[model samples]
Target: MSVLRIDTSIQGPRSASSALADVAEAEWSAVRPTTTFVRRHLGAEPLPADAWAAAITGGPLPEEQRTPAQRDAIALARTLADEMRHADAAILALPLYNWGVSQHAKTWIDLTIAGAEKGERLLEGKPAIVLTTRGGGYGPGTPREGWDHNTAFLRRIVADVWGAELTLIERELTLARVNPAMEALLETAELMRKAAHEAASHAGRAAASSAR
Candidate 1:
């Protein structure tokens, strides 16, 4: 199984959400050492429109864009899509930016899903887990929580657009319980890791039996 680990944190490499995601990914990898892995750090490397347009249009070749700055844009998008599809699982690490996904990640999402031929979501059918670190709580039943947009938007994108099974791991401490939050994160990752592994194992057995 291959796993695509996408970190959309705007804080570059120091993002807390990305940090936790790395841990979860490592755990998953340890369980399945042969799993192939690919990654996209959206915030650190924003998606370009020119390359995106070229790729979507399939005209003039994305590499022919002219100025050297446009370099690698087209190839990156193709590589990103290829990586996503080659993987059997995925991880999205990011924070709730203004109650929604960061602009960087949003761009990647647009280029990835928009106008890709039918039956094309690299994310489709994959077991995808989202790791988040929020500065406040946004759970349902709270008036202010309704203000949150990440869950609603991401849910639609992951389930409807990508046809993927989605899980969420969040650290929302509006009242500041630092240690407990870390512990909770660890616990959640453990559960997610176990579930992913068991599912893969079950699928393997089923496939073996069907081969008879």
Candidate 2:
């Protein structure tokens, strides 16, 4: 069994969202040391914007006839699709952009969403946790809280396309330095740690049972 960490945090290590993802990963490692870890860093080697557009425009791949770039795109798409489908559990480290997901995040979703043409939901019924990093507070209250597009859009895509069980852990790292705000953020991370471990233990048990 293993966990796939999909780090979509555009800011790399500086991303608060990625920090939470790391905490969650550490919890998993402690609770399930036997589980392998797989990392997909979008910043390092982002998938092409049109990798899976094959279903709509390019049609089936003809490897020999395709350009080098086209071949590269298809290969990444296939690899990503398989990873999403096969992982026992997955996490998406997200960014809050203009009150919604970043363009890169949306592109990843479009390529991986199970659709009429794709036929199978590689993410169907799997569990996924979203770690959101943001500059301002947003989620019903707080100034930019309306920008809390993280929960809603993620829920919709995961439910409709991937069918993955979902959890969201968000922290406003930029707000931490403002007096007690840092404490609040740390508390949120603790809550995320608790939840991530419980979920991991449950998934690990399920996998064991299935194997038996």
Candidate 3:
């Protein structure tokens, strides 16, 4: 089996979202020992911010008439889209950044959409686990209850647009341990972390079973 794993964490080893993804991948690997993973690190290697626009503009032009940038952008978009289209399962680590989706993840998502056929569900009927972490709590009754603008957008794309059987693992207050101001919330943060990891593990095993 082939699984597409996309990590968009600039924090490297310290990333909470990536840590959850590792848990999921480990569980999946345990179940499917011979599975192959196609990896993409958008945070480590960001797509060109202008690539999506170039690809969009180049779509109607003949190959010979396209500029070098446009040609490259189109090719890159196709590669990203193909990765999702062909994956048997997927794991995505896309943390919330500045109250919204990070530019790195957004660019990757846009390019993938640009490359696919219009309205085509690239991951149709496939299992996809999305691990998203937040530095602050935004749940009901919290001061920032309505401030989160990341998770819902992801749900729309992964489940509604791509048509994946989505399993979302979310952890909030990720900065509690590091931010002195959030000391009182440390316990809550730890609990959230554990829950997210547990969810990821369960999702991974489920994904493996479903794929099989």
What TM-score goes with each of the models? 0.68, 0.73, 0.99
User: Residue 97, candidate 3: how far off, in angstroms?
Assistant: 0.3
* Model 3 vs. true fold: TM: 0.99
For each candidate, what is the lDDT? 0.63, 0.63, 0.95
Per-residue lDDT of model 3, residues 107-191, tens digit only: 9999999999999999999999999999999999999998999999999999999999999989999999899999999998999
The segments of candidate 3 whose C-alpha lies over 4 angstroms from its true place after superposition are none
Report how far off residue 60 is in candidate 1 (Å).
12
lDDT of 2 by residue, 31-127 (tens): 6678776787875567666666653343354666676665665556666677776688776787677677887777677665522236566666666
Better of 1 and 3 by TM-score: 3
**Residue 71 lDDT (model 2):** 62
Give a tens-digit lDDT track for model 1, residues 1-212: 66777887777665667766766666665567666668778777767746665555553534455444434544566566677666777778766788777777777876666435556766666677777666555667744668777767877877678877677666654223345645555555455445544444443333222221
Q: Which is superior by lDDT, 1 or 3?
A: 3
Q: lDDT value for candidate 2?
A: 0.63
